[model samples]
Target chain A: MMYIIVLAFYLLFTIWSSVKSLKNTESISDFTTGGHRMGLLLGIGTTTATWVSVASVLGVPGYLYSSGVAAIIGWVAGWCLGGALIPLVAYKIRRPETPVRTFPEFIHLRYEPYKQNSPLRMIVGILMTIGYFLLVHIQVVGFGIVFETITGIDYKIAIFAFLIFLLFTSIGGFWSVAATDTLNTVLIVIGVVLGSGAVLAATGGLQNIVDTLSTTTAPTIAGGPPLEQGILLSPLGTFSLSALISIFISNSLGSPASPHWVTRMLAPKNIKVAILQIMGTIGVLLFIMGPLIILGLGAKALLPSLPAGKTTDYIVPLIIQDYAPPLVGAMTLVALCAAAVSTANSMLLTAGTTLYYDVYLGIFSKKVSDKDFNKRLRLIIFVLGFLAVISAIKPPWFLAMGFVYVYGGFGAAFFLAVFLGLYWKRMNAAGAYAGILIGSVGYVVSKAMGASNPFLIAAGISLIGVILAVYTTKKPPIEAYEPYFEEKVSKSTDRVLSSVINRSEGA
Target chain B: MVTALLIWLGTMIFSFVLGTYLCMRIEKSGVKRWGATGKIFKYK
Candidate 1:
């Protein structure tokens, strides 16, 4: 009965937030960028919420439970470094003169320079769409797992429920996503922090956890080794140093290149808001990851046995269902669902917007009004969301591996170009194209061949491609690079200041 | 065991502080610069 009430409240809150945001959304810009007037608090809240996806909430903890502190160093430490690096890109990418709604559009404007048509732009756009689609699919899979665990429903039915929920939330665009994401962030913090506290208290505290896990052997799943004593406490417990370093680099460098996160960087009102958003994301991550680590370790100690065929991903849900009070268990379940929905909505929105603006409009449509474009974007959102739900019905793998594939793929393909294109004047269209092509192809070939570090190998090849192409190709003209680097005070700033002052005087 | 716990806690705290400080510095560097207020919202 308590579970039913909590689920009902979740549904009601989602609907209310979507409806309120729908009224505020007017044009494609409003839908895609939230009118570019988001304050620091809302900006930070949404970004953090979006970043803390099902992968972080569920997958990270599970990884910690199974693999020990190595997971923490790879995910938690690496992600903090990644979040901190966002400011370097946020301010420059969100520069007022070349206000781009999507990351692919930025690529076109930056790389193609004088040309109205660039295949490079189209390729990047398509790649971003594909990456985001895979990302949304993972979220849907997570939703199915959580829903099935909590409600005892078939996975297929849970997926349909998830699709319906996200469709309504995404229809209102960035406004709805940001508003609901902020609310979800608050709920997630409460759920994880309280859940951790409950688990710790039940397990008899920190010292007890350390003692219990020290002697306890972790469950063997899918033919993996059992966790021996002292492995969970060591920094590089089971993983090699090279593997840990690779994981850290891939996560830190690849994250900012993600379309959903890039969209968040573009939504804030000003550079200051963007910085605040990054900082807020860091704070939330630290808060969430800290307690989650404790909870995961506690689970490893307390629930050492899993039924046959069950994976570590089942640990958190199992603990909550079996141990916690009905109310707390229901709330935690709701929080996990919220995490999945927030991420899926953002990914779907980014994919839909990229398709509409970059592919449909940039290549096919001659003239599209803002209203019509927004209508098309909404349609694309529904289409993409439905497709994701269908694909998620038969997930490729467990959540962690699925996430790694997409994240690593994106990092290998786009990280070098994004970082160098912004800072290196010598980086030309040839270099950008070559880097993307080589990086993507190398990653695919290496993964197919079962290379141990496909991501790192692909990234190395991409970097070489970038260097060779830059040296061989002709450099872009000064005008092509000016927009990104120039810091001259434009007339627009003067007008904004005058307008603010006039409004104050009139008041 | 105590040392390991202290190391883990210390790393998390350091990350949080360092991240916050870097972001603050980035924001401060942008003050008074053009485009610091970001793009104008033409569409309301």
Candidate 2:
């Protein structure tokens, strides 16, 4: 009854917010970026809510339950490092007078503003579409797991609940996403804090849980792999030093360059808002991570072995069901749903807009009125969201590691391309193309070969390719490089950029 | 376990401190390129 009431209230609030935002969403700019005038509260809310996806809630806890403290160093510390580096990207990317709406648009402007037909934008658009589809699917899978566990429903039926997010995204676009995300951030904080407090009460305390785990060799789940003594308390845990380092690099170094984060930087009102948003997210995430760690360790002590047919992904729900008060369980489950919805909407909206704004309009030069464009975008978003729901029905195992693969791929492809484009005056379009192609392909090839450090290997190849191409090719045009480096760009350059935006259908 | 907690807390503190310092530098760079205001609710 509590779950039903809480869910009803959440649904009502989301419907109200989405309708309100849809009324104000007048232009493509409002749909894509809230008119490039987002303030601090909305900025931090959206970023933090998006960052704490189902992967962090379910996957990180599962990792800690099975693999121990290594999850903390690998995932938590690595992401924090990435957050620390985001101000650099924000400062430069938001410097232009008229900020670009999407990451691919930024790429187009930085590398080849003159070439409307550049395939670079198309490539980024395609990759982000595919990647975000998988990401949205991951969140759906999470929702399915939680809902099915709580309600005893079939997974397919439970997964369809994700349509709420799709509806929200389609109606109001970025404004709906930001407004709902603020509410989600509050729910997630309260849920996790309540959960950790319960874990402490149930398991005695943190020290007791640690002492018990340090000496236990029992399997984490029935008929599963054995837990080695002292492993759970160790820093490296079961991971080798190489594996730990790779995880760190893939998450920490890869995250700052990821398109979702870069797009977040562009939406804020100015550079100060952008940088402070990221900083504020880091602060809130730290508070959240502490409780997550406590919950994971306490679960190990409270439920030494999960029953057969349940993976470690079941740990969070299992704990709430057995240990938490009824009201607390209801709220925490609602928070999990919020995490999935907040992230799914962001990814779905990004994928849809990138395809619409960058590929169909910018690359192919297909002209449509603003009304027609917005209408088509809604159709595209609906189709993509439905496809993701189908894909999530059989989501792969180990939710956290799935994100590592995607983040690493993004880092390899865009890290050098984005940072160098922002800072280096001589980095030509050819070099940017080479970096993106070689880095993404190298990362895939290395993964296929089962390389221990695929991200590092791919990143190395990308760097060498970028340098070789940059020195061999002619320098970029003055117009292409001036806005990022100079205090004020030339009038001709400004006109060119303004024209480019106009040509790209006011993107 | 204690070591892991310490490392996690330390990294977050470092991030906050470093982020603040960078924000300060960006603020002092120039007012024309970007403004220094951190408005709580304003949006264009």
Go through the candidates in order and give the clash count of each. Answer: 0, 0
A504: Cα error in model 2, Å = 3.1
Candidate 1, clashing residue pairs?
A: none
Candidate 2 Cα errors over 4 Å, as ranges: B37-44
lDDT of 1 by residue, A145-223 (tens): 8878777889899999998779878999999999888988888888888778779878989889878767766554634
Query: Could you give the fnat of all candidates in order?
Result: 0.13, 0.68
Residue-level lDDT tens digits of model 2 in A170-247: 558889899999899999988898888888999898788988888888798888888889998899987898998899
TM-score of each: 0.90, 0.96
Interface RMSD of candidate 1?
A: 5.9
